[model samples]
Target: MTESTHAPLLTVRGLTRRVGTRHLFDIAELVFRRATAVALTGVNGAGKSTLLRMIAGLEPAPGATVTWTEADGTPRTTPLTPLPQALRRQVAYMHQHPYLFRTSVRDNIAYGLRARGLPHDEINRRVGAALGWAGIVHVQDTAPDKLSGGEIQRVALARAKVLEPELLLLDEPTSSLDGHAREQVIALISELAAEGRCVVMVCHDRELINLPGVVRWKLGEGQLDTKHR
Candidate 1:
């Protein structure tokens, strides 16, 4: 972890996860500061995704507190209240492969806003902005499967970005893209962090994580290493 030891916006304490005979994470404690960019890197099967899933509440992690700051500004180590439903909207988790709904790219990004009860014009405006930000404006009407790998990833990112979630959990978002595409995605991630949304990305590329001011965490040997500058 970085020596600064600042108060964390997202705190994970005594987190433990077990699958059969293997202990995925053992009482792991880490914190993610608000609006910061944190890169998680490790070899295959290193529990990176599992850890992210735990934070997103997709899987159960016992003996831990996923705490958020109270209105009064006091720190509390409490399991989130009203659980899954509330967390789902607050946390946006994007997988390595973008999941397209077999619909048009516009519809895919619009789905998130519509779910939040946004009006048609408002949804259109947000989708347009997201598409432009993701650099997929040219493919706005194409079927997701028909788009190139980079385009698909951009659309996936657009879906998550349009939601404007508090936290974004990404899984190797640039792994399948070419060099230029990867740079574009990385830039977008940097911009998101600059905009004050906490972004946790699972990426193994050293260069990619070296984006200005990003913190690095290595997951290996059944544990999350301290954050590295």
Candidate 2:
């Protein structure tokens, strides 16, 4: 991964999650910088996925303080209750088993652009580029049901990449894939980081964990052990 001289894109303080009366995890502070890739690791039920969900605004953490720093050095901090649309647009989250629309791969990739009401030409341009970028152009017209696991994952990545998010959150992106398929996803991930996007993934795969320049953060015993390389 190329080193980034830019400021951190997102920071969180006092991040905590609980289940009933039991605490799942507590993170004092977490920082994510552009052009960086982080692998969050821990044993089962360590709340790794939960943390990513909270950051993506898909889960609630009532008292957590989340701050998003813009490219212009402006900082916007807010409680974790209601995330602003601006922040939401800057961060994209992909589940391990991504849920694709019951439509063609190209149409699925165009979903986000259409939702934002972009011009027809712009959506087409971006979708086309994204399809090629993810190397799934061969399956562009295929239905999700007809594609393999690797193809589906690549389609999901294209769907997220077309929006050009600054921060990408992935949960077990390469789980249960064949050797060639896994390599393809990992290469795409590296390319994403190289392009100056911050990527944080919940992963246990040694290949992903030991990826060059990847920082590993371990979550256990209700605390987060952060290590930067």
Candidate 3:
């Protein structure tokens, strides 16, 4: 497909979510352009996490259509009530804290591929490459719980990256990291976007507001506004 045919990698229309009297995201429509990184910025309780979760299909959000297109040109929209299993596998969401399996870091990265019927050798190769990309190769065989906060988060990202999802949803991926670790995480995200993966990150920091080639969207008072740069 040419650049002109690069339709939105993700589209949300008339999205709304509420927890009792609290309104999270009341977006009318939002489109995440193909091969671009988009940052969701707002205050602490401005529904950043909630919006990411909705896009990832982790929870029920109201009146929204979430669609993802594969490189092969197949596209799928969100289904009512029950989400298709194939769509679920095409989207990966990373939480603030990486939840590692009881097994080694390698096993955690291989979990998704194993479930998808990939061979053991393929899983090993993919996991190794992902670990190297995330810059956590030194701890490939170590247990996750014993790793630092940044290490754990990187491992989680490695796991998701190995799956090669069409869309990646991140919620505060660098929240618990120090200066150097934070930069590493941000750089990794930039690299992913450059590789033509659609990325949506929930961030409160100002540094991301001016990230090169990133579309910034802010949520406030139950509204969504674009601060395109």
Candidate 4:
């Protein structure tokens, strides 16, 4: 593998999925070359969340191929829906209302790093950085059940940030927050994309969709269309 100035980091070819008896979407030849945020939107029940989960490497579909091009131009292929465990760690999926553990904010943010078997000192160091990233350092000691909805979302963001995933899948991140909280999350989403992370968000917010470097896509009629935005 050698470094290439122009090469997509990932490619999905001949992708298809079945939701019960109906086909989920028609996707073919999709490339993720830019670090900009990709905003997916459609009517309710359009399987927006479903698509994100699949791309995050959940249940796999046969005949669907997902290939990733490394920084050095090496290409690795796998079933898009069921990425290998190690590759899966490079992708993080966050729910509309992400679940928080029954522990302090610090612990929640440290979960992924700890799960990866990092030393205690390293985990602590990363957790502190994550808290700062999400602007939740002040609430590092707060329990999940005790925090407000906005705070919980921030904590969840911090937890996900700690993993340093290349692909961040967000399911309606700002749906349950107030105006101010929504702004905060939006800002962070933009920041993540600008920092060279591939961010795909399921959001209906007009403002969020129009953020700088955001590419928009519509999901409906049982198809996923790229290069149409």
Q: Which candidate number would show the highest TM-score if scored against the true structure?
A: 2
Question: Whose lDDT is greatest here?
Answer: 2
lDDT of 3 by residue, 1-229 (tens): 0123567766667789887988766777777765777788878888888777777777776567766676587887774224456667768999887678899988899999999999888988999899899999899889977888878888888899999987899988887887877888888888888888888888765665467777887788888887643
Better of 2 and 3 by TM-score: 2
Residue range 165-189, candidate 4, lDDT tens digits:
8878899998888788888888888
Positional deviation of 226 in candidate 3, in angstroms?
2.5
lDDT of 4: 0.79
Model 1 collision count: 2
Cα lDDT of model 1 by residue, 4-99, tens digit: 444566777777767798876674568777778889987888789988878887777666777766558876566632244544677889999978
Q: Given candidate 4, what's the lDDT at residue 139?
A: 88
Error of 1 at 45 (Å): 1.6
Worst lDDT run of 10 residues, candidate 4, spans 1-10
lDDT score, residue 135, model 4?
89
Q: What lDDT does each candidate get?
A: 0.80, 0.89, 0.79, 0.79
Q: In model 3, state the lDDT of residue 130.
A: 97
Tens-digit lDDT track of model 2 for 62-160: 788878866687888988666676787888999989999999999999999999999999999999999999999999999999999999999998999
- Give lDDT: candidate 1, residue 110: 96
| Candidate 2 least-lDDT 10 residues | 1-10
TM-score of 1: 0.89
Model 4 clash pairs are none
